[model samples]
Target: EPEVTQTPSHQVTQMGQEVILRCVPISNHLYFYWYRQILGQKVEFLVSFYNNEISEKSEIFDDQFSVERPDGSNFTLKIRSTKLEDSAMYFCASSERGVGELFFGEGSRLTVL
Candidate 1:
């Protein structure tokens, strides 16, 4: 079955650098999400998109972060300036109806030094 795929499986960057994580969500799915887990912490919701627009976002998704669907299948998450605290595993996910079971990518690991 087709699944969400992310690039640069792992990345190491200096603080204040920019990072753009990419993903190709399931073609038939209608909703997309960007979630992150800070090392040992629980997964946190960053943003959700549907119908080509963000449906909702969490407080953690401040001006430093943004999400986009650059094409029919490509979805992306950009961190304007990486911080040491931003180091974590970022996951891209999709669901057929924006709820219920979600298909998740293996995740892009970010390391900010």
Candidate 2:
């Protein structure tokens, strides 16, 4: 079975820098989402994308953040300026339907200093 794959499983960056996290989900899945978990905090939703447009987003997805499906096969999340608070484990997920089980990738951990 195909699963979601994320690149650079671990990333270290300085505050004020930019970072792009990449993921590739199962080929037939439709709804894609980005979620994050701060070191000691609960998992939070960032944004959801479908049909090449943003379907839903949380307040955490602010001006500093953006998502894209540059190619049909991969999805990406870009943070324009990093902050210490931005350090978190970002997970990429996809589901065949909008309301079912979401298959997730091994999170990409971001560390900002």
Best by lDDT: 2
State the lDDT of candidate 1 residue by residue for 36-112, as single tens digits: 99888899999999998999999999999988898898999999999999999999999999879999999999999
Q: After superposition, how far is residue 86 of candidate 1 from its true place, in Å?
A: 0.4
Best model number under TM-score: 2
* Candidate 2 structure, TM-score to reference: 0.97
lDDT of 2 by residue, 1-113 (tens): 79999987999999999999999989999999999999888989999999999999999999999999999899999999999999999999999888879999999999999
Candidate 1 Cα outliers beyond 4 Å, as residue runs:
none
How many backbone clashes does every candidate have?
Answer: 0, 0
Whole-structure CA lDDT of model 2: 0.96
lDDT of all predictions: 0.94, 0.96
Name the lDDT value of residue 21 in candidate 1: 97
